[model samples]
Target: MHNKTKLLIFASLLLAACSTDPMQEIPNRGDSAPEIETSDKICNTSDDAVAGSLIVKFGEEAIPSLEQNALNAAKTRSALTRSGIESVDDILNDLHVTSLERVFPEAGEHEARTRAAGLHRWYVLGFASEEDLDKAAERLADVAEISKVQFRTRLYRASDCKTYPFQATANGQTRALVTADFNDPNLFWQWHYINNADQAVATTSVAGADINVADAWKLTAGNPEVIVAIVDEGVKYTHPDLAANMWINPNPSPEYKNQDIHGWNFAADGPISWGQKGDSGHGTHVAGTVAAVNNNGIGVCGVAGGTGKGDGVRLMSCQIFSGDLTGDALVSSRAVKYAADHGASILQCSWGIKAGIYTSDNMFIKQSPMDYEALQYFAAQKNCEALDGGLIIFSAGNESTAMSGYPAGYRDYISVTSFSPDYLPANYTNYGSGCNIAAPGGETSGLSGGEKAGVLSTLCSETSNGADYGYMQGTSMACPHVSGVAALGLSYALEKGKRYSLDEFKTMLLTSVNEIDSRLGEGSKATIADVSIYRGKMGTGITDAYQLLMQIEGTPCLRVALGEVQLIPLTQHFGQGAEDLTYTDIQMSAKDMEKLGIKAAPKMYNGKLMIKCTKPGSAKIKVSAIAGGTKPGTGVVMGGMVITKEFAVIARSAGAANGGWL
Candidate 1:
């Protein structure tokens, strides 16, 4: 045989080997292979025809090699007779391969290789015809080198419907208001921040119903080191309220050079733009709730927008959804990986698959392996050293059902449900065991006050380069509130030189909530029969910003002996050198002591409170440290400001102890 003919024959054989069913070559391929299935149920939809897309996991093969193998396979399949094809390029013209791209190169080489070994390289392939795409996916599934294969699925934003305009009052009544700062005119209108008892300003305001952001702000508005990634449609980064707190990429590669100044738009595969004309205002509103510039003398106040000193947590716009507010699971996963790889400490996602689309029993049946791997990779990255790991928060969904949606329903993410100003579950908020916590998401209808009480935050004008504000209600709105509160908790932890692992942080958040059912006289109920399937099933309770910070600050818990005299050494609880503090310097209400049935007064005997328990109950006691007499010889006046600590005292009867107590 001629040397040239031998080489050609060898090349054809190599292509044939690459094109054949690789899985058939595996030992016990049938037993080990993942089941490949397709359904008429729409995984994704667009104005164009429903193009068939597949997520293929190429095991042990680099992306470049996988692409070459795919090309060879395409050419071999296109050729009617191997001997008749002249070149790979000639056969390529006969094939209609629309797209074949790596799903998550941004996950980085080392991490992807280490964490997701056989599942490292995920490619999304699109075909012109659904029939052709289905056949291709089946062929890929048969390849031994491929570990997993699934149809690319789609996800939608948790709907945030604006039932009323921004300034429209439910009753059309004008009322007096109080402002946190003279510059922030709209601060008085933010009932979620400070729910004052005044009915005129906040017709629906319930005392202690708010997140208590005002008290948290006094400790530390926010630290600029914290970065939260808003994974939504797109944020109006240029909006005056959000511009200052927008995360600017310090370093950009040649491909993203000068483009990703604010953040990346994963939907467009380019730099971030707010959105084109006729876009929904979801992302901007969500961003504003997270970190709109505070005390700007314009717009509503953000929960953690700082004290107008350029110290707010920065927000990175990870635009997964587009103008039409639609997105696919593949891009959304990439956006998550990008946020984790970048500097974002907290990822606030107000989007998820619709709940009724997949139930818990069949969830894994239709689960996309690509998305599962990407989220797992993200969960492993410790982006926030201060918090011990990265945090991802999601909305529980607005289906008004008991179940949660995907990603949010995933154990790795914190699922937040919505609660109205009346402290009831928002009419549309999903509830069940999956809900990690509840926050004020707001509701505009079905209230006696006719209160259009949806959350108010910064928004963008429908036209021109302008900014506006609006009210939107959903678990979408509630998710960001938790994100902002988590930021505040992180800020407090960092300042206090305390650190918590991701799980520990979640525990703290869960434990810090006020027991709403107990407070509402619905003792021990997991779910509200009127609203949710299971009573008391909502994870932990409603998030309390003040309590979360207090937990981070190492507040002490007091266990009092009922009907007996007990002494709590203040110095032990408050740290050393507390003996110099006096009784008058410590602050506590007589009403609080009365509630606990404790006759207690701050009579410091070596910096300890002398107390007598009159009965058995519980009360929260607040104490403050006063300035110690000037330090000897230094002439330095110390402790001018009062540092307060609230301690929860549980008084138990001495002789009435139950066997369970022992």
Candidate 2:
């Protein structure tokens, strides 16, 4: 053949290889639109059809060239209207228009998004069909003010409605059931965390011999004044053991009569809703795990069992799931926001779904990898990143694959896979990503020598028509073990006179895990302090209650005075320091103090130093070595230190001695 003919043949072959054929690609889109599988059952209504319109986004390719362009354009409303564009929102939403974001030229600091004209402006437009996409592009071509048009696809998800048996409310008021009888040996062994007197009080269970509940017991047993929010399906706030620990939300919505819906109802249904007759009981069970009133000699004991000595970790339910919790991202996001805004340092989402469960079909692993997109969103929203420090712990999942579910997939999150003392990932548990870490989620019926991972916890059994605690398996059972440990960690951090961001807290939790010996290899371990220390299992060696408590006690408390950042570097010496030692560089400029609403200055009357807190909550205390290092010029804010003794008296009385000024 001639050279030209051979070249033509090669060209033809390349074209054929690049042909749009469904039989060739790994994930063939075929002739149809992209199939974005959502967690919700696709709604087949007219509304859904309307909602199916594609929402596109265009970035820098779609913003104004400069601030001059915006100023030069028609300034009058009529002129803009004539040009077919009214405002920014319209430009962002309308398909016919391409909206451009305008930036000012005289900005002092170059903002990342504002450096380029359209650099960071997100464009969102809707399209009903491919033909509509074409028309939208045509409109963009004709509009000078418009930059570019991009079409984007959105994923939709909803909740799954799985029903378990049990009344949602046990007493129609405050209280929740956290334990049950040991009638069923299988279940009894499973829930050994709940009523197992031997496990609760023993230094360790049969899993290993070194574990003890003393630290968890000490921290919460006396029922210290801590409040933990149980953000889950609405709790049966009326369960007997949980009432005392249930959080009362002082701030509630006007639509509801109760503000402390502390026990709340975020469900779509009402009091007489379909499942109200028998709540799934996941939340009640979880509440029991955190702070079920202990030693009532009735149902069961809690991680922090005290007559009310523990700082009450209030159970504030942000009902995300009715029971099944199918896999609703929007609902979960809203619940997380609610919990964070309402002062929940530790957020517990015990239930979840594996959104990516079928991408690949490896017979051995049997599930898809964790959803990266979903997990990213959760991690990004963690308040500890840019807001206040917080931690979110989720079960590694029960699919038995080497992958965790969404939310848990995010490394910023505490990914908790389950393991038994025998040293094995639960047969039904998920893992991989090496994810965050592993914990004792307990095992199912399958184990070597008939030995299984056993877990004791609160259960809401439908068999009795009311709430009851019991043992269970799966990472679902394993998640709370980690959550309880996280709570303990948070308390430890708080006592250290310091706070950790989400990343810091996650690091602490991961390192805190104890390892056990198992077939999963040397890396497989759970929290230490709970059992006989085993090696190579990946855990920190069982969550050591005593060791952790000692560690907390060892952390030096910062001696911060009111209205100042004083670096009192902790010394080996125990007990409070003498009154004469001064905390240097306190930010107490007249203007700074005044801005904080402090009318009185701490005067050095004779030899005593006195101060007062005029404001409630946490106020600022700035300190700096230099006279003008901080704003209004001077010091770093003294954020730690108890001020109740003096602040309480002043807050109640306008003229209360003002606490002896320095």
Candidate 3:
């Protein structure tokens, strides 16, 4: 039924919407190395082949002793030769060692010492056979000049290997079969989807409430529209609930026309499909919360979280992972660049590989120009290529540790952590100096032993065998909420004709956050120093649509009316027995008074307007009128009257506003 209703909404909007357009996608950051022409075709061609994992590092001592190092290298080469190893790229092209240092010298001294102290080490190429590896290490170990010769193993699953279908396992239920090794913790974290529960109280209140959507509307119903770019598994494009909110990029070019579902798949994983109607449910659930079709009386409501609801902004899907196990930072970076290159204002990432800082164990070494440069290059791209320097929201991870994870720990992005409905941080959420904010991810309250997870809007799985609905919790889930709020801010800016760079938006989000509890710990409490550290840090606090709209345009007055009072300047206050200041019901006789300028009353409590009701239950109220034609010389009457106090005068409404008082 929910799907059907969503389809109906999509139908209506599709009919009224403009047609699809073309796209002129920019190329990846730089050109690739020209393919080597192999006349014999003997070299390995697979990106995941073991030969590709060869790692080597050079030190100042090793560089200066070129002949000695080469002699050591020859001994190692002989061992590899005896073991049937075909290649060794470690030999220097020239023995010319220079006294001048290259690369990070300050850090290099520490790195060199760390190596001597058994911290930063060096490695030669890994081989397919252990016997070969041992032989090579033995040859180098025999050389007196060579201080160390170590052989390490690194796994290489083919980059184009078998694709694993998207699957989710939770609470005794499993959505899809695990074709590959699903039990591996590393593999699981690589593709998992989590939840967001920033406002569990408010979210659950509305989710479980019986009130209709129309009445629940506010000035922010759809105000401050946001555009969230999901860079993960592909969304069910035609999924009834998610179709309408998908962004439709308006321009197309001949080279790449009709790319306007505002979505694209970049994962090497084969045959990507929207986990819909026989698909994986991960992307569907995410889409539902981000901008699922709302108010159709079928499924759940998205956090549209603002007024003016035009299908609640838009969602752009950039698929970097599919059923295939081919996901990597390189691919993810491409998706990031794509989202920015297009009009996607904000990017939401829920996937990443666990990689520590560059060390000897890293596939690439710090001093080596080829591989290490490639890894740091992406971080550079995120900072340089993003549109308007758009913000990227990332999950802090579910590990519950002090160690910062990649991308989330990148510091350049908005790292969000998860909180339960009760406002306590989720036990599973990872935290450290990098975490910027926390949102409700959902868990029961009271019991110290309870899960206390975060919660937010949910969606039906595109892959569900039978469209199911339930709650999920994690920092992964918490990220989209911030993303949605960012979208809302963007929409607000667009609607009000205001401009905000990504930096300014970050400023607004950080400062505007409603600090319910000082859960930031003893040392982490926000202070002047912390604020400065976070200057332009966490994007403006959770977006406040009402505040944004009001800031954009001064308050617009509606109609003002006074009940049963005529012929004097209205003085409203308690005359002994009357209700306190708020009881007065002042209605506007005409909304048109907004156009004609007259005397504007005090909105704040400083002065200008006063409320005085005579002596009690007599309950008599008086009102006076002044129009544009009132003579300039007329004396303003400051009239006061006293009557018998009887019953109290309760304020039904409040002020008469600016124009005229009736």
Candidate 4:
């Protein structure tokens, strides 16, 4: 039956049968209600509701009737008082009557009304106790005027705060170091930026196996305009390396004007401090990796932190995790919306739903409706003042399985997997086709003598009141690498007056990876075959910062094969005056050809360059073009200007092909 019709029939029945007291007709209920059960699940919130809080959903056409019933029940119960007399005004005063409000209220009434008009069709109804709330629900249950009634619950973070004890001294003495110099003294210890010959300690020959951030830094370190919202635990804005880069809200709402100087703390429902007291510093660590002040002679260098010139990308703390490494899902959803609406270009989330009892084989679980809608809303916030669209990145869970949890598994977001120092998938990182990229999320446990192999960044001691530094390992650490690189890409684009849609930005990030399969063996399996479940499935290889920036520059060098007699096609474009003409402008160094063991000269064949190699080697080939008119003898205008571009050619021998093409 229609809801309105049902409500009318139910109201008529109540009027005809009860006439005097509606509370007396409620079934299966005494003066008090029974307690509900609670669970230990990550987001299961059977016990999270405030003591007297209840969420009641009244049918669209039954709000007035529901209110009248509640008033009548109060009046009927008050009549049974010791005085044996009651008035509607006395009942209202004794019952503490108040208007129903939204469960998750938005910033303004219009926004709240709009959201309520959508999926969230519930209200916050307060009572003196859970019993009162339950009794109200029982009274309304028989009436079709009510759709649903339940206690309000909350969701919290699943990951624990993992801190490394070994990074500190045996005596637990803090190091007193100067941080005013141009370069941080500990810069040499950052292996993810420049792995010195893949050595865990000591700075020697460079391995050049990292994201190649140093080279990209030369082009553009970062711009302050790009804001990356760290949507995890609250960041410690007081940390020196991070304080300079923290984003301050220019026009905060009155409720948060004093507290939200840096960013809003959704968990605490106030300004972004280091969460409630005793909170874990997960968000602070992630923010440091994204844009810690560089060259301040500080502890570490961030991926996109400027050259100590105070020009790094800004950091916003969307604190989802509170005192513990957990928080309410409703609060988290709100934080995401705030980040998207408040001008965050990139959203970095290093936490997600945990796969508690379910193993990798049964990992098809989905996200809640509210959580999914929050992500979708953020994804749709394109054309922000600073960016074309907001990019959402999530950490592939650290479950050591081939399954990723949502929102990482969500198709619209970029999922990042963990790669160890050896450029292999970290043993604990969850991986699958949903993984969009990989970064160095270190493995400190495998090293002997308790070496610090984990990713290093800013940290604050649980006991100490001051800022510090330490190491942490997880897909959490891996996520910010991509976020920072994305900031760099955005910085470059903004510098060059280029605007890319979110799709274009994601395409650039995914396509510009170092091919691990080509470098390592086929499938790019881990060296220890037993734990190689991620073989051929860990996204598009690891992220390459240099390559990504080069692609953004729009002059990427091409690679081709030579020994197989490959044909290289060319599309030549010239000035407006000169059209419909072609010229032969292929150039190759004789020395390079001899060095590469190429016996045949490259010849132009029907608008393509054809080359043959007699032996196995690599060489650089240069291609150039000049414009000419279609009329005879109007050839080679613009003084035969050579638009020289270099391309790489690799010649593989037959013997190598027969074996593996390593």
Candidate 5:
């Protein structure tokens, strides 16, 4: 909400910049060709498009070399060729075009898929800095070989976001104690993962308003098979908590020797530029939320971080934003394609075009064709065996508007909205039609929790005064939580030997949620929002990790009324034959029992399990029974094979017996 005191407490210090423009190095060969007269037609443009840059798609029938993925072929053979000029290079040379290059690299892993989808035809053309954008576009459009011409537009970037660095002794231990899931001390302050309603965090914090990763951690913390691409700024790969989880390219391009092993820096086309002026580690924070190392007695815990092993989902940094070089369609589109070409199945995109810039997908595609095709290409990729296509998650803009910004508002992908520790929409989070899910992004506006009210994760030591962890808040923070959960869900699916199509998996992800709309009570300390206004606008509800895993496990999620003792029929999970089977025992871990506040020993009665849940959360419990025989048969007796089934017990105030939590 941009509270002044909160800014003073957590805002990142603006780094002094004395850098030169990175775009001046492009070579110009326009002087050697015939000059074309400038056209007077007005440019169909917006303030969002970057100056002096245009993306053009070559027609398949005209420029077959580019359209057919003929990497070594020349652009033109003669001046009378079908392309309207001697070549794309010579033809563009007459129109102030400095350089022309394909947006996607030459014949990579998914080149066939890209070519079939028409993404191979996309090429970026850079013009002289003084060239008029409209005239340049008009001239390019006149070329018969050019199928489409669009201006390069900038994506969202926040180089100076808030940063509250971690300290050794006083910073972490001073907070009131609560059980933490990870050994990292700072995890206690991360109310977004597992809010325990500790007054020390925020007096208004909701008890179960977290992603419910705690219980899911017991089933499967993470699996290394899943990879997520952080398509924002360059990540500090050397950070201790993130280094081990970084994706290693087995066949690294020779140009990227020691550096760029994790992923290439598409922004500068070199090593990750973390030390640049105005760089505030926004990508690092987002990366931490997705796969930061866990239980190593250091930094914060990632949502998919493994149980003290190097088994977390790998993170690949596809940097599109670096310092003053906020991304253009030319660079960012390359990062998206790079993620698909590499082995990333989940794309963690925290940025987008400006809020309200182009609310509809048609407008976005028309204004920025390069980006649209890039995203379309990524969505068609299958990097992991468990999912048919990649999962691309974007943040609903932080503009406090009802309509989420594109490409998050595009509807084809998952758009995340932000919620607070109090379970209300964050003042800056955009909600309504486009938002697909809600997450705890934290809210630190005029609140008593200070930095504790915000989401905490890893940061660059240089940006955070030599500390490698910090706190920040935005829909940017919320998007990664969803990405992390999707990664973990895929990890669990792999463990369970299950597979799903992209659409099938997303339906489970969206349905695996808890109630949020019903919690909009006017409690004075909750929030400044007229939270009731966000009732049905905040997507399905808060995302639940345990519930998603349960969905993946093919286990029935039992809905129980909150704060009440009830009997849940086992038939729903174990089939109708459950009543005929002889039950041996029902078991649950002590931590899980406490997590659900089950004071009574859960026992089987009349083929049903009875228990009381005093709070809201999701937990896993096991039931063992004899399959064939009525009771357990010893060594000499004929008996049924012992069978065990796991069920996800979810407690919520607004759930029904029909299995609908929302």
Candidate 6:
């Protein structure tokens, strides 16, 4: 009944998005021991800890007053009373602790939640750069008041792993005629979102290997209510293509208090900046993939980009990396927390902690608690009214290893692997456990597709070889397609008056995929070595946008085997006793038939429609049948209304076992 206890309980509830990041409980201990090093290695190498800095977590006895005084410059220094200061000072001796500050800022949105999570208990200690980091951490850990000491690890913005700058057309502008969904000149090159199979991303192409978002677009373009945070390089919010869909901070809370009205730039501790030297526009490219303004008639398309209707999912830049700026666990921890506080429902991270360092769950959790805690806080947030919790999506490392990188490999969040137009794993993509779903990440050497094989999107003019938009490839690019599809599913759920819990929504998102293992046996663009190696590594096939929406709407899918002929009974759509009713013919457009790879003109035989498909994808068909009458020209001219119903057909590979009716 106490007010303080009630506040703590409320705070704890916010981080209980689902469960703890740890697999099993860690036994509590306050002593500093040499054998069991708890401050996880911040990096994969021996030089893991920051030279002059150490992160310390104080116990309950020492945090109360420090928390109250952390925001006040003068009081913060004095808050560390004699006892606590003397204990730390005795161990440091000559290597004096220069400055002390809280690791995480004053969380306005969920201050109590941050405290209850023990983030407020964590502090950053700066000392002389010459001291041995491990010795200092051990010394601090010996203090009875300090429960944990962390050597903050620094993270680098790895090479984007992109192919040569590929322009769809001569001037980086598309001359192809604009399509119905978007007028963006370069939408034709975005085969990752909607693949007719004809758009060449590489030498070997599959007709329906994309995310299957074309039909999903008809249901809804995108809802501004959904926001995806790009937690990589700074996004150029002023770019012509991404400007409209950028998340604007109307109220500018502490999270958005920076100058870039679009989203805060943690990399610079100021406004979002994508134009610094060495800026690869990696974040800008990723932002465009997630939710660039569509139908703008200038640049490429976004997966959740509005259908020329100012309704795309909002893009929020949570910049952790800029030109030469490197981010660490402490920096990224704040970035992820800021994303949750500022109304972002999805966290799109194209990078992760060291790859291959953590092979098990326990090891990662023990070594990397800060990143884990921040991610948990982000995932636990309920930023959108239509969704119960948030989704954290990351790229499987491009290290060409068997296991995913840390964070993505952490198992609690979703990790995306890369596939090419041929429906096989990218040569550079990491495969194996921790990889959740696969998306088109493009390749470097598609003999025929050339540079166009890479995923194309808006680029920073600084890095686009003089163009505002360009192309890049990697699991980084693949991750956003999943994020965009998630945004689309949420948008559709909102329009249909539906609400879903985080787990339920994630289930639909992962299951909404086409089978890829079937085709993985044969074709590839970059190398043949990855074909067999990727057999079981790519997660749950391809992320299909249409299937996700269909599941959300409770729409049934009629499955058919690819490259096979089947006679479908008309009674399935009409009544079982269709003989009694006046029957008309079934009609399907040539375009619709082509979408499913159906070749023959639709024909009805003995109340059954016969058709064959050469591709694997989803399409809609229309059928008409009369009621209360024998035939159109027969008796009973005033028959009941002609009962017309539409059915959705999804084709699957007969050789593949994972796909079938929905």
**Predicted structure with the largest TM-score when compared to the true one:** 6
Give the range where candidate 3 is weakest over 10 consecutive residues by summed lDDT: 204-213
| Pairs in steric clash, model 1 | 22-144, 23-143, 23-144, 525-536, 526-535, 526-536, 526-537, 527-534, 527-535, 527-536
Clashing pairs in 4: 156-327, 157-326, 157-327
CA lDDT, every model vs. true structure: 0.64, 0.40, 0.38, 0.61, 0.74, 0.72
> Candidate 6, residues 1-662: lDDT per residue as tens digits?
01222233333344334222132233233355323343432323226656787776665556534433332433333332222355655765556766666666655556766665666656777778888887777667666567666667776543363425545544222233113466776777776765555445554666566787767888888999999998988988889988889999877653334454777777678888877876788898889999888877787788898876789999999998877877777778878988887889999998877577788777776677667778887888899877899899989888888888878887678889998776677777888888899998887565467667678888887666667876788899899999999999999999989999999998889888876666555433347543666777889878888888888887755656677677777665566875445557667777878767787866566676677887666777766776666555437555455677666777755344433211
Model 3 lDDT on a 0 to 1 scale? 0.38
Worst 10 contiguous positions by lDDT, candidate 6: 18-27
lDDT of 1 at 601: 66
Best by lDDT: 5
Candidate ranking under TM-score, highest first, comes to 6, 5, 1, 4, 2, 3
- TM-score between candidate 4 and the true structure: 0.68
- Over 4 Å off, model 6: 1-46, 68-85, 92-94, 156-180, 253-260, 522-526, 559-562, 566-591, 594-610, 614-617, 622-647, 651-662
Q: Positional deviation of 583 in candidate 5, in angstroms? A: 11
Clashes within 3 Å, all models in order: 10, 88, 77, 3, 0, 0
- lDDT tens digits by residue: candidate 1, 1-662: 01222222333334322332222222222556554332322222232222565665544323344444444544464311111123322322333545555565422233323233333345565545544544554555554445555665667778654534466333322224343442666666666666533364345445455676665676877778888999987788888888989888887534354477777778777777654754667888899899888877777788778888898889998898776535777778778877777778898999887665556633633354456555665566676657877888999898887777777877768989887666667777777746788888877665433334678787767532343777778899999999999998888887888888989998888776754453333222122334323347556777777677777877665655556676787676667877776444455578766655555564456677666766433456776665554322234744354566777554433322321211
Off by over 4 Å in 1: 1-50, 61-64, 67-95, 106-119, 129-133, 168-182, 197-204, 361-366, 448-451, 463-467, 519-534, 557-586, 589-662
Give one digit per residue, the lDDT tens place, for model 4 in 364-411: 222144455566666766534435678999898787767665667777
Candidate 4, RMSD to the unseen true structure:
11.3
Model 3 CA deviation exceeding 4 Å by range: 1-217, 220-226, 249-262, 269-272, 276-280, 305-310, 324-326, 353-387, 444-462, 518-662
Which segments of model 5 are wrong by more than 4 Å? Answer: 1-44, 65-94, 158-160, 168-177, 254-259, 521-527, 561-592, 600-611, 615-617, 621-646, 652-662
Candidate 4, poorest ten consecutive residues by summed lDDT:
171-180
Q: What is the TM-score of each candidate against the true structure?
A: 0.73, 0.50, 0.48, 0.68, 0.82, 0.83
Candidate 2 structure quality by residue, lDDT tens digits, 1-662: 01222222332333222322111112322345243332111111112122213222222222333222334442332111112244333433564333332111111122221222221222223333433544444444343333223322111211111222322223321121112222222222332242222232122223222123432454434223344555565666666666666666665543333343664444442321114443555566666666666555446555543544435445567675564332233344435544555556666766554635322223111111112222232333333212245567766566555566655565466656666534344556555553466656554344321222345445555422443654445565556656665665555545555555566555555654333332222232233222222223233433433333333444311222233322232222212332323334344567435433456654322223345533311122332222222223225773333211111111111111222111
Stretches off by above 4 angstroms in model 4 are 1-104, 108-160, 165-182, 201-206, 275-278, 355-367, 448-451, 462-467, 518-531, 557-641, 646-662
Tell how far residue 630 is off in model 5, in angstroms: 14
Cα RMSD, model 1? 10.1
**Residue 566 Cα positional deviation in candidate 2, in Å, after optimal superposition:** 44
